[model samples]
Target: MMAHSPGDTAFLPSLPQLLIDDAVRAALREDLGRAGDITTNATIAEDAKATAILSSREMGTVCGTGFARAAFALIDPALKFEALVRDGEKVSPGEKLARVTGNARAILSAERVALNYMMHLSGIATYTARFVDLVNETKARVCDTRKTIPGMRAFAKYAVKCGGGANHRFGLDDAILIKDNHIAVAGGVTNAIEAARAYAGHLVKIEIEVDGLAQFEEALAAKADVILLDNMGPELLEKAVGINAGRAILEASGGIGFDTIKAVAQTGVDYISTSKITMAAPTLDIGLDIEIA
Candidate 1:
């Protein structure tokens, strides 16, 4: 079997610092492939100087300003980038995010790459904030799912944190989350639960995802420390919470959306995770504008 990549916690991943550096480097490489800003070379004179202002085109929680600056630095170390708004700061349309000034061509060249990271990361932050707000009054906290862009998990997860949602896990190796498939392969929930309890070391907690009350009951009976009540409706989830009775923590997941999340949160699950928080969230509409100075 092909090995799964690094830092995947079975539940959810926390950002590992080393991996963050790697992601930033890789993203810069993609933006600055061979040929190095041909458009800038052809038009803007080398000695010319200009300033640019990064601004928002829509309301959002700002994020990745440092990374965006780092992206420009990688392109040209002499570049001067200043942040007008810190990551996690809320900004409305037309608000200034940052200022950049250096070699005109270099600034022009680094524009797209820097803006790409800023916009993409801010999008995740923006959506995460919404979900977090939706469930703020309830006991449950908003969490991001494994449904993240491949190779951009850390960036997305970071934005989620910036927006006030907690991360689930980074990759499979970090945690032991036994879902429905594992139960089927192991013969039953009890069997899977037993296997996990028997095999995992003392520090590892066992979590299982179950689709219905029967499976949940089996998980509860088997003593799973964390029970993922997948796709269970509000009424069923309340029963699940009652059944857990302060034993296992319950997470309500599967097909959750903005319309239904508040209701799900009211069901008493300890947490609610959804892909809609990241996947398909529109870019927060930030842009970099040249300010000739």
Candidate 2:
């Protein structure tokens, strides 16, 4: 993980090279299948060389450059991949993002896999940025939830950071989040909180979800480190904040979209976690155009 920058809220620490290489290698393996780029091998000579330019077709925040580079490098180590803009930077339509110069066959083989990562991750970053922009004036920070595509949680969460949003717990093991289901299973909010508190190490902070004021009071009395106000509208959220009185970190979640996020932020919650940033984001249109020379 990269160090947080106080000045650039959108600054993202680079993902570990090993993780990037592993993901890219898997994607390339899947794409290549039993035989590798048969079309390229049949049509383009192995000695053929060319330059390909990656350009954005729509305005969006850029991400996953390292993944793209890894794709090309793993395909052919001699290939040169240069990123014109860093991850987390905003780009306009038709803006050139990266240039790849080397064996034409290698570029062709890696194109789709590279674009697949860039487009999907950039879309998440773009969507997350919109939510971040809407809530910029408030104390509330936009956050990404666990509702991510399986096997891609880390990438999705990294995209959220690129878009100027904070990440929630990466997985269930990282933190103890007592949701309504947990509360019900444990008999009550107080019971769940107490059980979690007793089981958790001193470094682990416990967060509980509550839908109404009564549950909120129980969670507060139980001394949960963080309280999630689930599906509550602005009015109820504001009231919850008043009830909280700085005793715990407050997060408002559920049914939050671009339309309602601003209102929710103004309710004085510390964070707003939504799945739309990752699950519902459309792929940003980016294309790779080869310039054979």
Q: Highest TM-score: give the candidate number.
A: 2
How does model 2 fare in lDDT?
0.92
110-196: candidate 1 lDDT, tens digit per residue: 788788888988888888877777877788878887889888887888888777777787788766899878998999999999998
Give the count of colliding residue pairs in each prediction: 11, 0
**Tell me, what's the RMSD of every candidate?**
6.2, 2.3
True lDDT of residue 229, candidate 1: 89
Prediction 2 TM-score vs. true: 0.96
TM-score of each: 0.91, 0.96
Candidate 1 worst ten-residue window by lDDT? 1-10
State the C-alpha lDDT per candidate: 0.82, 0.92
Model 2 per-residue lDDT tens digits across residues 135-197 = 888888888999999999999999888888889999999999999899999999999999998
After superposition, which runs of candidate 1 have C-alpha atoms over 4 Å from their true positions? 1-21
